[model samples]
Target: MKMKLELFLVVMAVVCAAGKPTSKAAAGRNKLLLISFDGFRWDYDQDVDTPNLDQMVKDGVKAKYITPPMLTMTSPSHFTTITGRWVEDHEVVHNMMFDDKTNLKLPHKLTLKKSAWWNKRVLPLWITAQNQGLKTASFHFPGGGANYSGQVVDRVLFEEFDHPDDNETEWRQNIDKVLSWFSEEDFHFVALYYGEPDNVGHAKGPDHPDRKKIIAQIDRTMGYLREAITRFNLNDSLNVILTSDHGMTTVKKRPQVDEVIINKYMDLLKLTSFEILDYGGFGILTPKTGKEQEVFDALSKVPNVTVYKKNEFPESFHLAKSERLPPIVVVADLGFNLNSRFIVYVNKGDHGYHNGEMDMKTIFRAFGPDFKKNFLSEPFDSIHIYPLMCKLLQIEPAPHNGSLSVTENMLLGPEGPAGTEKPGSGGSQGASLSVALLLCMLLFMSDVL
Candidate 1:
């Protein structure tokens, strides 16, 4: 009987441990560093040499591709990654938002102070981790400064757009700051952002030689970061995830948005107002009351443009359900930009077009103790990253739109049983506890027998 009781206690402990979430820290991996390279295309590494990133893949895991949400703009894509929600759900529908209620226009102007432009509908990972008593930090990451659920990260840095220039000195500083937070302040989670390839990709086309040069420079920065991690003896303790918000596409031509064509059809329409919300790729045309059909019919005839009513937009895009979206959304074909007045020349590249095109797919790679070495995962949506982060940090995620199943295969374990809960379901603490109890009972009964 004494032996049986001892065995029962040991089994109970094992069952209890199995049910609890294991944080990187608890598992002897102390830090998680999320790094973003804006507009890094899925295939950019193949076009140029990225020895540092290549080494990471050799040592860790890589996803084939990460599909961005609809619109595919920088701000929306980054927000989707952090919150694991769609643009409409997060209320940051565009980089520049016009609030009809307050009659205020919020553009993507760089500001250090927090603004009400950010919606609190969903909680980002920083806030979620901080709420669970883990120290968090963010450097120039979108949604970093925003107070979600009345909580901000313990350390925050808002770097300006031009900070990455000057041989990437500011980029190195950002990296140093994040390392300090982990080593000194003991922050468990840190988000770092760099505006690169995207900047050059916009100024010079994605296929341009300058873009390749920029990618190489970014790779060198990655090498620097890897050296720093090793210097601090953090290579084993740190898990670094590198990704991009969206990819770039070359613009071969611009479709003229002829006012004359619209004016010709205006005689038959009762259009109260017409405004273009987004201009380049995913052009949004907000029309006045009851004139959606008239505007759609007119814009449908435009060259290189496809018009869809809000209700008629593609269901796979998950874009039509947002109140913040315009009634008519126009998307230009690949290698084309929408322009008004005359044929505007586009000598460079642009994004924010259709998300279905492969050119819009971005990079996803991770390295550290938790990931599988040299493992290449199938392509997954970027929205699924939030739940993965929550799992890695051992924090209860707020209600989000991501699913653990989407990224479960990327980890170094069994895929396990499928979760019946909906995507972005809140933390499964109750479920975990219930499973723990059942296992405990089963072990106890076996020992008694």
Candidate 2:
């Protein structure tokens, strides 16, 4: 009984040890706030009067634009930034969770709970920081709500599919809440998300008047956020990064051009056993047994659509290597999307286009005590962010695909770690993941027995 008591105390000690600021960079490191506004194009503020974003550019760093992974949809692209892996490696391949065998599908919001799809080996920055003894929170960031290994983000605010994105009042409330987390609760990292502009972009198009209204609202919220940061007295210690998943494109409508609809060319139901189509610029088809060639040939012939067998997918996409993918992949041209299986209402605007397209590029702006002032960077890939975050927090990264050297010049300090430093073993431990896991297992067994 005494031995058990000692073990229990040890376990409690480890639990309590977490969330304390012990960044390898230093004790009491500057807090990081990563904010993502979905579908915010690089040039959205070019014509609009966005004083807050403009102030961010003058106060901190702004990128010409950052590239997202190919097949650039919401969930996959966001996951790419968070995990620092390509689409195939992270395996959060699409906005929808799908089972090729059962032909089952779950939309983006529902898929957040499906950890098997999101956290298959590589963990996000929040988990990595928590393991290194820094507390982290996420508000509506994609994949933030799911469990990774044996842990979840220290704090999370999840949403449903129908949640409105443009609530200015609620947006300020979230800013206040996060400010409290940093000020009163002492969180080292917090990721906030807004579904704006993306929702308005889809329903009313990226260039529509409604999008301008939402942009104005976003700017106003930014003003409130900056003010709240001052009110919380976090101005000296807080570092803020504002970016987006992917940019939006105006979808080609009817009458003016021949809208590329998949069903118009091939009998989709007759071609494949399962499919994930009508979502955006990409689609995956699981061909019926012995009918693989037939499906590939048919989709390939569709004008403005590009088709590939899973193995034949472009290597540059970083998506061809995953076994979780369907046998057949279909890609539509810019300004086009695959639909017709269940076309209810076509979005006036959409993303999931090739990352090379100018319209597909998203914005990047960051400000903090650690970052350089008023520096404008050339374009960089979103993958670089993971390693950059790891560097800022002074935590070892989890063997990611991003390069630290790409963004090193923007920091205030002299370049420290080369991009090739070794990584953590990816368990929830500050020093040694294996030892931590073993201790955790022992605690679990003791409690159960």
lDDT, candidate 2, 307-357, per-residue tens = 888897777888888878898888878888787554554799998878889
Candidate number with greatest TM-score:
2
Candidate 1 structure quality by residue, lDDT tens digits, 1-449: 78767766776676666566655345444478999988899999898988988998898889999999997887889989989898778866667756544445555645224455565477778877877878888887877877765677788877664564426776776677788777777788998887788878877889889888988888888888888887767775677889989999987642443321233434323562444433457766666777767777887777666878888877788887788776777788876676543444444788878888998999999977566678899999999998888877767888888899988676654221243332123236446666767766876788678
The lDDT leader among the candidates is 2
**Model 1: worst 10 consecutive residues (lDDT sum):** 415-424
Task: Compute the lDDT of residue 264 as modeled in candidate 1.
Answer: 42
* lDDT, candidates in the order shown: 0.75, 0.83
Clash counts for all predictions: 1, 1
Error of 2 at 10 (Å): 39
lDDT of 2 at 354: 82
Candidate 2: residue 439 lDDT (0-100): 85
